[model samples]
Target: MEYEPAEYQKLQVRQYAPRELRETAEGKYWRQFKAPIVAKQFGGVTHIDFCQQYPYNLAVTASTRVIIYNGLAPAVVGRTISRFKDIAYSGCFRSDGRLVCAGGQDGVVQVFDANSRSVLRQFKLHKRATRVARFGADKLHVLSGSDDVTVRWWDVSAGSQVLRLDGHRDYVRAAAASPASSDTWLTGSYDHTVKLWDVRAGGSAMLSLEHGAPVEDVAFFPSGSIAVTAGGNCLCVWDLLGGGGGRLLKRLDNFQKTVTCVRLSPLAGPDSAAAPRMLAGSLDGHVKIFELDSFLVTHASKYPAPVMSLGLSPDCRLLAVGMADGNLSVRKHARPKRAGVGAGPGAPEPRQRRAPRLTAANYRYFIRGQNSRAAASDYRVVRQRQVRLQAYDRMLRQFRYRESLDAALATRQPEVVASVLEELAARGGLAGALGGRDAEGLLPLLRHLVKYIAEPRYTRLLAGMAHRLLDTYSGVVGTAPAVDKALGVLRDRLAEELGVQDQLSGLAGALEPLLAASLAGALF
Candidate 1:
């Protein structure tokens, strides 16, 4: 006897299409999951930030009001009318999620209790519009930057200005506090400069760096050793640890429009070994997440309107985007898969287990030259094994409808069974495979198909095949009571699904004639 190479043995195998893999667990999780909630604001949403505390409430600012939403998915919790005289431009949630702070175009900085919606403190520090306001590293201080070219730190409990830093020649737009300490912070200005400051040192900036364009937003990496600034169409990164005047690390410019906002992932804590990726929202309707060191876009998502504000939850499990069209889009992160879990119990078990690499039968174990006594030689442990290829899959790929139907029925694999049924239905060979009117010849296959008719994963495919099978064998199929009962249930399910499709089709058909009449009327 001659032995052929494994590659040339002509064992049956099917080339799986990309869509077939979509039926796998990971694919189904990503492709089929739907967003559980979506809500709209009255005006363009200026900002959306999630609370740092448990229950993870969200703060949304639009027009003249600030609304706090509670729960994992957004639902209104409480709201506050910040300024009656003018629009509220910014809103932020404190580290404890107990306080909500916002800045108004009327130059007022207000802090309110998140739950009661009562104003805790209000500071009238800026002479012009207050563009941004946020709590510092500590709850005792609140920072606000305004068009008046000033950055003021107000004592929240004391309700007095602790210090005022004024150096920019133009309007101050964005500011961020360092996570490492409350004394340190960063602010961006329309004067084309980014200023690093220390609240401990009175009224002067510690360092100032030119950005060559009006700065839009500023954020500090979780470690506080790196600062990122968005302006015009570029993102500039600076190294706070570079000693001599904070070195320029890298400049990123992927957007064609002005970058509106930039935020660092809160998941990357101070003790993290690596810096967090940065999320930048731009006027071009895209939010780009970039890897810190590489400056490569790791992930990106698009919205129907320009992305004005972006916030990542403390756990990094959810991201909320505020769009220019007042649409708030929240996306949940895909959960990581566990290592040892497998397909459900209905999955087929392996028929043959793998043999040991070197069993006692192949290599006798010896210790100190004594005869091998390690369970000695065992033929069962050394036997060669090969997987039996799934015959139905290969036959279906080869277009052998009749043979594939029989092979699939024998294997009892629901997915393989559905594939064969779908292919037969698609190719107009379903009747031929059933051997019309020959009930004796098709009863076994019908029994196999009936076993999995109600399975959600394969119901649609089996339902159509069942309908065709019944029509072809209507005269003799009802002779068996058990088979007839199963067939009746399948018929009922298919009819219900068909009714839904018909209603939708009717709606679409009605719109066609109305659209044609409208076009004719317009022409006349």
Candidate 2:
């Protein structure tokens, strides 16, 4: 006669709360960027910009120099423009990628030839430090914002100031030129306001919007109908169209520190069908990517220090982050190769084809059923695998309840012990199982209960088991020294757990009034 094995009971799984950030396709795409290539600079990296042409070199402004890095090999410094006598800011490339411009602490804005590294033009009209400088969309003009609370337009050919707009009451630090028109541009100032200017309209700003905080940076949508401003811990979106004053479209306050930079993805091209994303870097060392349509964070990356500036390459293949610690970290995403194309010069050689194997008539072909595959209509024989019962399961099969509990306890697995306890309780034999145990037999169980009773997962089951044990063994407690000691330990542990819960409740109660007052003030 064949013996049947007892079935193992399945244990209940512990569930956890869902995380705020989930793994999505966009997150996976961002994760494909490999570990960064870190480069140290003499001073904090103030700005980073990638040229909009082939070979897309990057211009990084730091200390008193603007360093040009090869776009394909970001770790290599292609050229350095060290002509600035003072610290430089906002090093950027012209549309043609042949020229680079940067503002200096000496209140000068200079343009340099990318290949020659010679100053092509210099404008020193501002009375204070020029913090922002970039080429306009037309490529013939330059725009600059300075600490003098003024914005200036410059002619590259004549090396002279074309126009000066002075509406901002404080330092003008952030600026962006409109992609649709060369005459239109915007500036964000420390006065907590963003103003849009059109050279054709006048020397005055055509539109102005209050940002509610010291403005750090500004960016325009490709269509030029919308704009975004970065300020204290927030990004504000404004509608630039039908205008008494530009209307606020949305306010994004997901950051915990000041937002230092904001940029739209695919910076050098027309908008694609896929909704454009906004990239924002903050002093909290986080770079967050948000979908323009939904305005929800799609992905985020953390840096080692506060991110002062960041740039995504025009091709979207490179991401460079500038930190306050003077570290420049660049991460690159390798493009997937086509079906049969080799990756590069170092790709592995193709495997050679081997000679055909021996025919089925050979004994070696059939030795291990190596080529056997069942056909759709063929009848197949199924073999049953022998079941192996655990010690507790074997003991339970024989109806030895106390021995099964002892066996479960010997395994030292909490889940297995809990499952066995639940099985005994379901059969109406839990009390019987726990009964008839001597001091030596019951000490392990008591210790396990004491250790796990306060755990949320096993609390309810262990508590009931503990109560039953105390009731059954109340008369036998003082007879055994070990049992009495365990009981005292259990009492102390329960008291500590109760004290923690009481303190937590008191803290929550104290916070309630303050929360209510803040909510009321916000509502009013």
Candidate 3:
């Protein structure tokens, strides 16, 4: 005969647990980057830019120098340009990766040859500090913005300013050259306005729009038909082909601090035909990526300090963030090597496999009871396990309901007691198990009921048990002092819970009118 083990009762899940954040494709892709490599500078990192050509060198502008880092070996410094006597700003590379240009605190824009680190050209026209500088689409011209409230275009072949636009009343801090055309440029100013300029036209702006806050940075979509502006805490998108002045397509206010930089994802990847994404960094130490079409935030990353500038490589293999604390963090993704494939030039070699030991020829390997070992084709017997039960379970199996309840209570586990009580109720023996209990035996049950009756998870079951308890002990209430005191405490707790429910109902009623009014106004 075989003995069967009694099944353990499962406890009900009553508490609410918050759901975890769902991981998206964008999150998985971005999370492939390994831990960042941090570098410290003399002062805050004002700007970071990656070259468009092969090797994809990174240019970082800080205090009084521009440091060029090898893209493949990010921890290695390839070149340093320290020609600026004062602070340098917005150091960026040309499309060919041969020339670098940046603005200076001395109101000068200088271009340096990447190989020799020599200054090739300098445009010195602005009266105040020149803060923004970048190479134009043609790679032969440079565009610069200054604190003197002007935007100047310079020719690299000849050291001369080609075009100057002077419509901004405040300092121009942000500028971008269109990817589709060499004649068009976008500039953002502290006057809360973004102006689009075409060099073929006059010096005045061709189109202007109010940003409602001081503009920090601006970018143009690859098609040149859409523009994005970053201001106070908002990123705005505009349609350039919409009516006369263009229309505001969307206003995304997702950050609590100023948005300092905005950039578009690379358009040269295999997924280039897919909808593009916009990346924005804020002083809140977060960089959020949003879908251009839906404007929904798909992923986000947190930095140690406020992010002042950030750049993504052309191949999207590296992410560089410059912080206000002078920390430059660079993250790179390492692709997994396929089995049986050769490693790349700098990849580490695969580990060697060790040969197995000659165990069959060793006498000790077989002498220690090894002859009793079973062969692969041999059959074996498995012994059945003996069942073990707890004291409460054993009592319940014997149909001693009262003793089982006592054992469950002595365990001091609320779930165990609740399970026993539920089992007794299901078997239609609850009244008999609870009967014939003196004041000392009934005190624990009363205390447990009083403590848990207010909880929504146990209210329905516990409240019915409390009613039955009162009906059974109505005649003996005054005789037992401890039992009488517990009943009084339970009465007070129920009254307090009722009062809380009434107050919550009143609050809900008060908020109804305001919500209705807001909904009505939105519809109208």
Candidate 4:
């Protein structure tokens, strides 16, 4: 047997904000497609990153464990590497995505095989907590920053220290590898400065640029000629091309809270002349995407709690936000309007395979170059149109008599007509609904009410309407067969009810004299 949904489940679902209201730029940017897919965590998420290639797996660092998730289906954890002796703060995937690396509070950086969950290399050089670590462009070295105020590089093959660049006055928080060249990178520190590093040359830093506040996160543009840093509610972009150290390209300060993380879109590349967008995650649970050329926030969204980290899949279809409440929120784009093996826009329509009796509507549609399947879908019949009664019920409760009566009459349904009449009587709106209606327009509702004139629940409300309708259309009733029959039935039911009332009145009249006689005898 095949499974089927219940009847109530087959009703059409509506969007929270329909398409007509989202024509403006701001409206489209803020519209939420759907509810987020949530994954619970034992501790707050600290860092997240997606693989550089297809399948685009996710690496998340939380508490003392680093977990890997299949980006395509995030409901399950692929692997959990909990061998860390202390809290793990940051994690990233290598360019090939075959290995995952993380920095921990135990003053060590460890790299593990993506599938085996076994540590491939562990660098124990930092004296204090390691803040960030990621693979370099060469994929043979691991770069890390630590609370010891130093950024260090370790050779993955040798599993030993390559160089230690120490210049920051405070802990280093964020770092990024340059994609255009393997020898260069950038680091941001709480010391309120961002330093450019070149491992090929032995020095503290190739160049240092001053920022007025502590740096929380940093990212390099696709061309490696620009860099962005997030800190203290502001984002600063620098141009690294001029003869001087570097020039300030732009400063974005619209956020109301500190910006904790910044990431460049994976779609950005060096060859593209158009300015690419970057994402900024803040402590206020809001994420903003800014275009580099205009320095304007083009899109924004909110999470359930303060966003601790953010990542986007390689295909740009999936976005993951890690929140302070220990929940991961994943959002997806809407599916295309038409999708099938050969159903894309402008695809040639398939010819008719069989002949059947066709209607004028379908014939005209196909003649206009529309697909037969699409035309048939437009004329499909709906079995449960009663769901629209909810809207009428709302109007009646609000005393919108004109709208309620029109909707009830359109359906010619007994239950709906009776409901509208009862509400009109209760709210004193019968005159407003039917005061000036013509005979033809009011015939359907009158016929439905006369059929149910004997039921107690509907009798009182229907009787008043039947009398008012007859008074308006009495002379013309004989011209229409349906109207004449309904009028005769209504008259007979009303007369029968009046006969019962007369009998009850006479019995009360006789009992009144008997009661008076009994009272006089008692007094004597």
Candidate 5:
């Protein structure tokens, strides 16, 4: 509305360091980021990005990670694609689906073989981070785009660079080669242009993507007649049939932020008259789908974190969506057998949506925003917290009390559970998760209140719940000596109904409740 200039201009997202980047940059850039903001302007469904729940892939930004869900049941399956030491600018799958190649801010391209969980190789490409990589027309060759504004070729099998494709005025953000032509390639740059490359002719201007903002990603449709691009928030499909001219097939104008990833079906429509299905993800945490022929958005998935990467398996039924958080989700698209209007009671069962198969090996895990040195730091913190939680939970099951307390106090059994929670507190995880809700987390939580929390200030607030439960049962009859003595005197007469017995006082003093459950009604 009004221009107010301070002493200096604000730094851009690129200028901010990984740790120093602005908080909520996605909402700031996507003016209509908030729901109310969108509803105020246009009364329509705002968020539409399809988020996968299975772990088929991971998308990384700065130090945060987004998992790509492989459309499996309870999606967000598979291993995380984590292994990078710094912010990953770009990444892609190998031709065989075994290797994931990524370029980081340190000007290094690290190749991680999915099956081995090892870094096969890491080599410096340009002074700046590399952005994108595409398989050469034959799949033997590899091409990478860089911030230094050059495209380099790699002999992937040899693990060495064979040549560099130069000739761009600004940083090249996207690079792709025509699937049919061995010598032909295309690269899009921040300089507001996409150029065609001919390997035989040796690095010269071939064509450009005429768009408003810098091109983030580009891909060729199966027909090769057009190339699709996710630029800023808009989706543009350029006509490649006519010398690759900037013929717009369709555009979605209301996307609130930059587009993250896009995928198009390899097979066009079922028959000649069918339209292709296009899926696009964005930084605002939405994946939108459009029918290529009609240019209409037909489906969407809303996510809590920004989507950073995406992939589709050999069959398009499984769509993997990656979020800025360290969770990948895979969503299965199931079409009803009967397409038109619904009519039958026993329709051939609505097909189930499922995530693709994901294992520790082929999991698309995005290791983002972590420097190599910092990766070591994150692993230590994340893993230590995990183990601490398990230990704390195990200690609180509270199988039985009276038969165990005297022995536990004597053998340090309660002390051990207390010690474990202390260890977790040292790591800073259990204490936070247990917060106040730990009252019922472990039965021992009541047995050992000081272990989870030193102060029971809020716990006495459960007096009402205690009254309700007690209304249905008798008092535990222990807190005071008089009540204990009276209960003991009356125990013999009520033994048959309450199932009480004068058990041995010897062996019961040494075993845990679980170990104690094995030996019932034995005082000896």
Candidate 6:
């Protein structure tokens, strides 16, 4: 049977997409909004680090278990992972990757050689939890930020504390090293200020940003001329250039929620365009991206938990988000394309498509006005391309989504065309698009495949394209005929898979991040 939708059937697409996707999609339709990052959960993401150079990352659990994953699949790092006795508040890798250290809640800093995956050295630094560890370029200095209200510098080779900076009067939430100068370090605290200090230069702050709440994270842009701090519900930007002390740029207040994590693109350079980009995970469960010179949310991504921590790939393309659930969402972020950017003169124009990883239950679709046009010629051409794509999609899905997404992005496939048509006609995308969209036949075929193929979770990479169309209609309106037909389709589709939760408690504590931005003051 051929995949063709009746004029009436095409309108039914409104319900086939998942409720989470719909809520976001509907919100997008209201305004030509920039996308916040969409987050994927990683093994109950307690902490995350992108320094390892792979989608592979290290995340910690409340009990101090460190789990590692190589982007899509996960593997426990070592047999001696973290136990109740040796675990504590802070942990990080040395620049050479040979040594990784963790601060124990019991007031000890222990270093482990990752190659052997064994503890190398242990030094008791405080009476309480020592929260963080970092190695400075000058191999002589190792910095530890702690809840003990003091930042200590240790000579790694000497195995002793060389100096202790006591400026911060509250539990230090985060600490960072300056890119160009290892002698420099910055720390943010619950006391609402960030202090910069030099281990060699004696005492006092070199610079400070007086925010009003706990500053959860701090980072320096790759260029070394700017630094950012996330506190309360605002991301305060500062300039680290010019004579003497750096000054505040401005604060982005739209987040309307506390920011739990902050990171700067590690691969930035000196050109103004090369200015480092910032990515943040929030109490609201959204990862927001900020371009340095201009302080605005260039894009946003969503996750389902309080995004307490995040780190970026060495290349700045993948973002590893650590959610409260201990799941690390290794997601690909869109890299900035400088003008005059070209793939190749002879290569085919890249067709816009949904992300290579998309789960129908939590997927986002983008249909351009031109793409969704009722033109038969356009449909025919797209239909031809989607045909081949359908065959490949089946093979990939069968592989438990372990297959690389390179294939989904390899050709100019009309996947969007096939998928939208299927959903409109009551056929799901996974099986229905692979098979043709014949109303009667498509539904039965989907039922068979549904039993065998479990869907992968999808994060929205690009949603504004379809939202642009939804915007024209104003809250899902259409011509009288189109509206009636769309309702019929939405109604039937919703009845089948659209579940609703009448009680918020059933949604669970996991959804806290999802509500944070909307209820900032009430909870925190």
Best by lDDT: 2
Ordered by lDDT, highest first, the candidates read 2, 3, 4, 1, 6, 5
Compared with the true structure, all predictions reach lDDT values of: 0.75, 0.87, 0.86, 0.78, 0.53, 0.58
**After superposing candidate 3, which stretches have Cα over 4 Å from the reference?**
1-18, 267-274, 334-524
- Residue clash pairs of candidate 4: none
Give per-residue CA lDDT, model 1, range 386-449, as digits (tens). 7445676566557677777888778775666666666677778776777643444566666665
- For model 4, what is the alpha-carbon lDDT of residue 234? 92
Q: Each candidate: how many clashes?
A: 0, 0, 0, 0, 52, 29
Clashing residue pairs in candidate 3 (N, C-alpha, C atoms within 3 angstroms): none
Model 5 TM-score, all chains together: 0.48
- Residue 514 accuracy (lDDT) in model 6: 65
Question: Where does candidate 2 have its weakest 10-residue lDDT segment?
Answer: 336-345
Worst 10 residues of 4 by lDDT: 336-345
Maximum-TM-score candidate: 2
lDDT for each residue of candidate 6 in 26-137, tens digit (9 for 90 to 100)? 1232123223333333344556653342323443433464444443233334323474374445456565445666676787777776556676667676767776777677
Query: What's the C-alpha lDDT at position 204 in model 3?
Result: 88
Evaluated at residue 265, the lDDT of candidate 2 is 82
Over 38-145, each residue of candidate 3 has an lDDT whose tens digit, in order, gives 999888998999887756789999999999999988899999999997999999999888999999999999999998999999889989999999898788899999
- State residue 496's C-alpha deviation in candidate 4, in Å: 49
* Backbone clash pairs in model 4 (N, Cα, C under 3 Å; residues 3+ apart or in different chains), count: 0
**lDDT digits (tens) for residues 1-524 of candidate 4:** 99895443221222223325444443353353346788888788889988876566788888898888886677678889898998997888888888888999989999999888889999998999998998987889999999999899899999999999989999999998777888898999999999998999957788898877899998988888988888898999998776588989889997888899888866541223235568899989899887776878777887769998988766455678898889988775443112222122333344556855566757664575444354644867646656543656656656678777887767666566766666676678887887666656566666666567766666776777778876766666677776677667767876887788799899999999999999999999
Q: Supply candidate 2's per-residue lDDT for 236.
A: 96
